[model samples]
Target chain A: MTVTDEYLSNNADYAAEFSGPLPLPPSRNVAVLACMDARLDVYRILGLKDGEAHVIRNAGGVVTDDEIRSLAISQRLLGTKEIILIHHTDCGMLTFSDDDFKRGIQDEIGIKPTWSAEAFPDLEEDVRQSLRRIENNPFVTKTESLRGFVFDVATGKLNEVTAS
Target chain B: MTVTDEYLSNNADYAAEFSGPLPLPPSRNVAVLACMDARLDVYRILGLKDGEAHVIRNAGGVVTDDEIRSLAISQRLLGTKEIILIHHTDCGMLTFSDDDFKRGIQDEIGIKPTWSAEAFPDLEEDVRQSLRRIENNPFVTKTESLRGFVFDVATGKLNEVTAS
Candidate 1:
């Protein structure tokens, strides 16, 4: 089969039926950074499909050094141009200090924690801080765009937090 | 405080400090979609950060119609150029077929299963299939980059699952 066939058709099961590698369109796709809060269910909330966007997750959807590295790869190697920072309200991680989180982890898994115990106590502030953090970060994709939002845990909603 | 002053030295603790109705950046950041498998921590593995990418999560990282809408927003409203697809080995979601999964949900959670329960039986094959699935998705950013990888559950390594 030709290369175009793989990514162009939806009739076959990718797992059990299809046999060819997909032909990538000669274009750049978008990337998303969001929280791991189970309630968010970003896939359903955003109504996404397979292979559309690269979704990055972390506590509170907060940006960090590691997230930067992947974003760079997405930009430098993969050609991503945009980023969306989605942090939600009433995130479980938000209720406790970073230390409290560490203690919880210790209690559950019995291990030493590496991150700060005092994480973002306020989801909105974390969103705002994360927006600037990425804008100022040298590692951020300079050519790409950046934005931040606070998703309401109660309602399927989005409230803008920061823009750069 | 002046915008520059607030952004520069403090890197303020936003969780508690940010007020509502905040300003947003002008740039249209990119979007990314990945799996919700606990073993595949997108931020830790991909090295991403806030304001860099928008992330979508699901059981198998399968492409559904909804994912397309999110990608559309990332492209029309936000600016994105690429997408990274990551799937990991030994995912629990892979352990059961759709029937078993739904039945388990009904039995355990006492709620009707709301989503599809199709199971991906193998890791290598799953990633390969995912590549084809994403390549052919119609709602994807036509001009965006798409790449896929099979992340090792045990070794903590990511190898390009789709050679092409």
Candidate 2:
């Protein structure tokens, strides 16, 4: 069976015990932008209950225009005030350079992607960079608290990254 | 204290019983793209163990250049083959149009966002739209299975969206 089918079977169990239809808005008034790493389960790590916060994730959890778009919708329409950004140790984005990745794709497909892969060598700096992106953006203005962190895959501890 | 601080406290508890780092690549060879919804916990809904699948999320669970970037990275770098797209019921994306959302932002701030808000009128259609986007993308070539679903909030069941 495909893993999707396996997950679908799991979904049946989830539905059997499910008590949901939570309110539309986030209960905690928070939004989290995190990496799409298989290891970083944002909900359990942050002790988030269902419907507590909006969770937005991507490859590196970097703040691209799409992230900005998500945050705008989160804060503007949904009343989410706090924003949390999470990058982690041993991220795939750190393993390769943007040019090399795009070049590899171009070599294979004969066309290069125009978008930035947003690979960063420094984790903390990228965390700070994401923080600054939100801080400086015009659309995401409803912010009472904004912070960034690096999740250590080994210990599963989130280390805060202060802006330098 | 901010909610961020509260979550930080929770992180300490998570770290107390945490396990060592798993391998970087997903064990299940799967990647999930879902909406940045407060209610749908993708891991729980799919019964995913840590380090199993990469979960990428954003507003509307729609496909854009950023998603293509992430999916390309997932397929190429991490070796994920199956792609799952999820959009839940009662989505905020259905509440408004892109034009209205942009206009609202424009009225609040003099400068309107150049990016598409990606609001969709129909859930199943959008799920198909997301699926088609992935099927047709040049960068995300390594796919063995691709499917889309609309998660029902009240029942907590994933209703599969077949291509029409």
Candidate 3:
């Protein structure tokens, strides 16, 4: 069976015990932007219950225009005031440079992507960079508490990254 | 304490019972793109263990350049082959139009966002839209299986959206 089918079978069990149809807005008034790393389970790490917070994730958890779009929607329409950004140790984003990645794709496909691959060499600096992007953005104005962290994959611990 | 502080406290407990770092690549070879809805816990819904599948999310669970970037990275760098797209019931994206959301932001701040708010009128159609976007994208070329679904909030079941 395809892995999707295997997960579909798992869903039958999830549905049997499911109690949902919660309110549309996030109960915790928070939104989390995190990396799409397989190891970082944002819900359990933050002790978040279902319907508590909006969880937005991507490759590096970097703040691109789309992330700004998601954050704006979270804060303005949904009443989410707090924003949390999570980048992890040993991230794929840190493993390669943007130019090299795009060049590799170009060599294969004969066309380069116009968008930034958003690879970073440093973790904490990138976390701070994400924090600053939100801080300076015009659309995401409803944030009351904004912070960033680096999640250690080995210990499953979140270490706060302060803006330098 | 702020909610962030409360979550930080929870992190301590998570770390207490934490395990060592798993491999960087997803074990399941799958990547799921879902909504940043408060209710849908993508990991539990899909029965994904930590280090199994990469989960990428955003406001509407829609595909954009950022998602293409993430999926490309997932397929090329991390070796994920299957792509699953999920949009849930009672989505906020269904509540408004792109024009109205942008107009409200424009009225509040003199500068309107240049990005699309990505509001949609229908759920299943949008799911298909996301699927088609992935199919059409040039960067994300490593897919072996691609499917889209709408997750029912009340029943906690995922009903597949077949191409029409």
lDDT of 1 by residue, B1-164 (tens): 32223222222233233334321211224344666543344444443433345565554565544444344434433456566666666554465576764564456547544556436787667766666765665444343566666655545556666644
| Candidate with maximal lDDT | 2
Sort order, lDDT high to low: 2, 3, 1
lDDT tens digits, residue span B1-164, model 3: 68999999999999999988899999999999999999999989989999999999999999999999999999999999999999999999999888988898999988899999999999999999999999999999999999999999999999999987
lDDT of candidates 1 onward, in order: 0.52, 0.96, 0.95
CAPRI class assigned to model 1: incorrect
Residue range B1-164, candidate 2, lDDT tens digits = 99999999999999999987999999999999999999989999999999999999999999999999999999999999999999999999999999999999999988989999999999999999999998998999999999999999999999999987
Would you list the clashing residue pairs of candidate 2? none
User: How far does residue B98 in candidate 1 sit from its true spot (Å)?
Assistant: 38
Local accuracy of candidate 1 as per-residue lDDT tens digits, A1-164? 32223222321222333232322211225566776443444434443333345566654566654465445444543456667678876554455455654454466557644534325667777888878877876545444557677776444566677553
Model 3 residue A41 CA deviation (Å) reads 0.8
lDDT of 2 at B148: 96
Q: How far out, in Å, is residue B126 in model 1? A: 15
Clashing pairs in 3: none
Alpha-carbon deviation at A33 in model 2, angstroms: 0.2
